[model samples]
Target: MDTYKNVVRILDEVLSLEGRSASFSRDTALLGAIAELDSMAVVSLITALEEQLGISIGDDEIDGDTFATVGALVDFVDAKLKD
Candidate 1:
């Protein structure tokens, strides 16, 4: 789950949560559920994940569900890496 940890780090930094993301779990709420996960944050997160994981995120691939939870996000990143 290295990608998961990397994403969590990105989220933590993007949201300025002071490492609060360390406490997040698979079921943790994201996207619109998190105050800091606005449109700009989404763009930043996508860019960070793409750069860090060396994967391209398609424009059509962007969706709220992709950022719904830690597990979902991990799954997305894993899928991208596999491609």
Candidate 2:
């Protein structure tokens, strides 16, 4: 998933946030902080990450904490890549 960069790209594209995510560091908050990151956007983001990164995300493996911050999401993808 290319970790931070790709995750930010996916976030920017999926949320239609222009380039706002470009400045996001690992500590940048997601979920409630971004108005565009609703339930539907989260689903689309997950799909995009799966397709673009060629990683499989099982239904049972997701939770709100996974979307807590940029670092959290990147860590999730990193773990998936390692598997």
For all candidates, what are the clash counts? 0, 0
Q: Which residue pairs collide in model 2, if any? A: none
Q: Flag clash pairs in model 1.
A: none
Using lDDT, give the best candidate's number. Answer: 2
How do the residues 1-83 of candidate 2 rate in per-residue lDDT, one tens digit apiece?
Answer: 26889899999999999999989999999999999999999999999999998899998999999999999999999999889
Question: What TM-scores do the predictions have?
Answer: 0.92, 0.96
Off by over 4 Å in 1: none
**Local distance difference test values of all predictions, in order:** 0.88, 0.93
Candidate 2 — number of clashing residue pairs?
Answer: 0
RMSD of each: 1.2, 1.0
The regions of model 2 sitting more than 4 angstroms off are: none
